[model samples]
Target: MRTPLAAVGLVALGVCLMANPLFLPVAVGEPDPAYTHTVQPVGADAVAGLDSPAAEARNGSDLDAVVAYDDLDPAARAAFDRARDAPEGGFGVEDPDERVDSLAYPTDPRLGDGLLIVERDGERYELWTRTVERESDVVLVQRVLVQPIAFLAGFLAVVAGAAVALRGRLGGE
Candidate 1:
């Protein structure tokens, strides 16, 4: 009874996941706003171009530049590759080493993209950001969805497969 119920629940959950998947948070290639907004000398001028990106990059923050995802271990490198090969909207991949292991797919844009498991060496602490540098008006946004509709078909297959296996093992319902 429990097994059957669990299988049914999985199907329902998969359906919900298809319609309204989670909206993940992401950062892009840009300097920190606080640092960018800081008042600093521009070239030789104290106030000229002070509110520019050059000032932000010179704000003395190590994180001033976007993460170098390609320069990581083989495991991380694989994730970055899958992201690069992903479709226009991006795709997801299962990385056991990632923070969640399953939602480890990195979504990359046409220009460039990178991902870093900033915490615990896993993709869970995802700092989803783009590698391309665009104007402030441009925004790169992508979400992770692992074959939303296909999950439903897979769930059905599991349920049928389980029922058959259980029937053969138990000889009856």
Candidate 2:
């Protein structure tokens, strides 16, 4: 009976983990000084083509084939075109996410940059993006989520310790 209960609990725990959001690839790439755009569950049909290969690749190979940056709306297209020939922005001395920003670059001359990602959780997918536009004022999103696995593991440890103590005291051979 105890073995079956443990097995059922294990299966239940696995299911819970599978449903978690932290298990997904939720990356909080560096903020772009000139970029300020956020899209969740990105619509591939509209923005995919406008995205550069670098953006597509960062999101994953599947998006590399799917994003058609050419399919973007005219205004968005113009924004990209403007950035193509724009001057490159100054690099800050203490930027930690500069490497990630390098992977996502601007297509126009206006000196903006961006990144797109397809975060996967089980059979479901979430699209996330970061765009840097050169402007005086900018608002950044805190794109981080907590991991439930660690909390669950800690809870299980406490439960297991109690169970062992109970068995030793209550069940005598």
Candidate 3:
């Protein structure tokens, strides 16, 4: 009886762990809301202006702009590479004057028709009129499902083994 109870307790603990795994809190740096909200463009043409040569000289280019990690695809990757190689974080926008030192990917991203937001080093940059080369729903779903099932299965197996051991020990008369 005690052995069975112990097994049940172990199983319950395992279930709880599966339900809510331990996670560390992420430290988000201070966001430059002024730049994220005010300076960024709100339309398609404004986005294109950033990509032109004249714009690039000013640290402006749609390609050099920041984007969310999730929204990134092949084209985005190529753009990122081009931007990374650019003189000043790709936008051609200079630091201090524009107050933007290096363009980077956002910690969180929201995407819409011809628009996306990139959060980097606690500031958000907006990009417009761009294209994505690929999308991966399957990969995203797989990432979501795998963790819980794996934990639950491992927990159940351990509980079953403990219960069997207890039964054998008690049965010895």
lDDT of each: 0.39, 0.40, 0.46
Which residue ranges in model 3 land beyond 4 Å of their true spot? 22-98, 101-157, 160-162, 165-173
Better model by lDDT: candidate 1 vs candidate 2: 2
Greater-TM-score candidate between 1 and 3? 3
Pick the winner on TM-score between candidates 2 and 3.
Answer: 3
Q: Write the per-residue lDDT of candidate 2 for residues 68-113, one digit (tens) a residue.
A: 4455555443333333323531222124343233334443412123
Question: lDDT tens digits, residues 1-173, model 3?
Answer: 66666666676766665554443122234322222211253333544344446556866444444565555665554544455455554443212244222333333433443345554455454553221222244533434665566576757866775776577587932
Query: TM-scores of all models?
Result: 0.24, 0.22, 0.29
Candidate 2 Cα misplacement greater than 4 A, ranges: 22-82, 86-173
Global CA lDDT computed for model 2: 0.40
lDDT winner? 3
* Top-down TM-score ranking: 3, 1, 2
